[model samples]
Target: MSTLKILFVLYPGVTHLDFTGPHQVLSRAPGSETIVASLGGQDIEAEGLTFTNLADLSKVDRCDVICIPGGFGTTAAMLDEAFMAQVRRLGADAKYVTSVCTGSLILAAAGFLKGKRAACHWAWRSLLEPFGAIVGEERVVRDGNTITGGGVTAGIDFGFVMLEELAGRDYAEAVQLGLEYAPDPPFHSGRPELARPEILAQVKARMASATDSRSEAALEASRRTEPA
Candidate 1:
């Protein structure tokens, strides 16, 4: 088989972990090349970290896999016509369409996830309704060629899942072993369901502004597109 190209669609304000978690794993895939691109090949600042010298989104022509990582900038990225245009075009031809965190929203906005069982950050999962996405609560959800991961850390899981699909279980496990992919969190507060009620409340309160704005943006983007 020819070498597989896995391309990451990046934008400003991306959660650093969301992109790197998967990149770190997928980059290890045998016979695969991973690339990162952004608008005009400009630098991107994600959570204060800067990524430079990226491929220009418009200039990227093809990929076997395309991934969009989610972040605080997701709402703006969804609304950007040029960015979504690139997403739609690449996704149309890719063998696997995927996202991590709110990145699924970008896929939804591009009309790639309609009637598709996908995953996204739990806090914003409901936003998928506007784009006709069927929410999957699992850490990693795969519906045909579209695979999505929930929240931030799920990207690592997403990487391995897709890596196994492209390669095989043994190879994936081997990579996992090489990377020591074991998880033993000291805190049990990762998800809202697992967190104490007060803690969840505090997070929700802090996120209210972005959540509300993102909700409106999703509705608007969905309205602009014809349902698939």
Candidate 2:
């Protein structure tokens, strides 16, 4: 059997769980190989950890799957025309293009989400429609070749879903068992809908600030693309 090559796109300040969680599940699949690709062959920092000498995006020629993770950096990445072009090119060549959290924002900026049903973090779900996507609030949303997940931890579920679609249900089940996929949140406040009203309000306020900043960045990027 041919090995399935999976490419992971990363950037500075990416959320650790967004990529790592999915990687933990996908890497365990039989005949699967994973590679970390970045804008350049330089080290990037994420959640206080440094990943060194990852594959340069410019050099990636092929991949069975492409996974894009989200974090604060995604706001900047969505604004980078060169980066979006690269993503568009690579994503076109890959069999499956997937993202977690606000990473879908980058894919949208690349013009890859056109007419696709996609999911993103609850904090930024409204933004996807501007890029021509039908927004889905589900933890894992699949629209044709595009798969998106909500928030950080959703990557795990997204991975299993993709695994089932790509490999098989049995393969996905075995990997889930290997990871001991059981959730036991210490509190019932993990989801925004289930959280206390005061807590939800606070979280929304913080997310609003981030959203404003992301909007500004996207606008700036759009301005840069305008004919001079």
> How many clashing residue pairs are found in candidate 1?
0
CA deviation > 4 Å runs, candidate 1: none
Ten contiguous residues minimizing lDDT sum, candidate 1: 219-228
Query: Which residue pairs does candidate 2 place in steric collision?
Result: none
Please give, for residues 1-228, the per-residue lDDT of candidate 1 as tens digits. Answer: 888999999998899899999999999888988999998998999877999989999998899999999998999999999888999999999999999999999999999999999999999999998888999999999999999999999999999998899889999999999999999899999988899999999999999988778999999899877845
Computed on alpha carbons, the lDDT of every model, listed in order, comes to 0.93, 0.85
Q: Which residue runs of candidate 2 sit more than 4 Å off their true CA positions?
A: 219-228
Candidate 2 per-residue C-alpha lDDT over 120-209 given as tens digits, one digit per residue, 9 for 90 to 100: 888788777766678998999998889999999999999999889878999899888878999899989867888999999999887777
TM-score of each: 0.98, 0.93
Question: Candidate 2: deviation at residue 162, Å?
Answer: 1.2
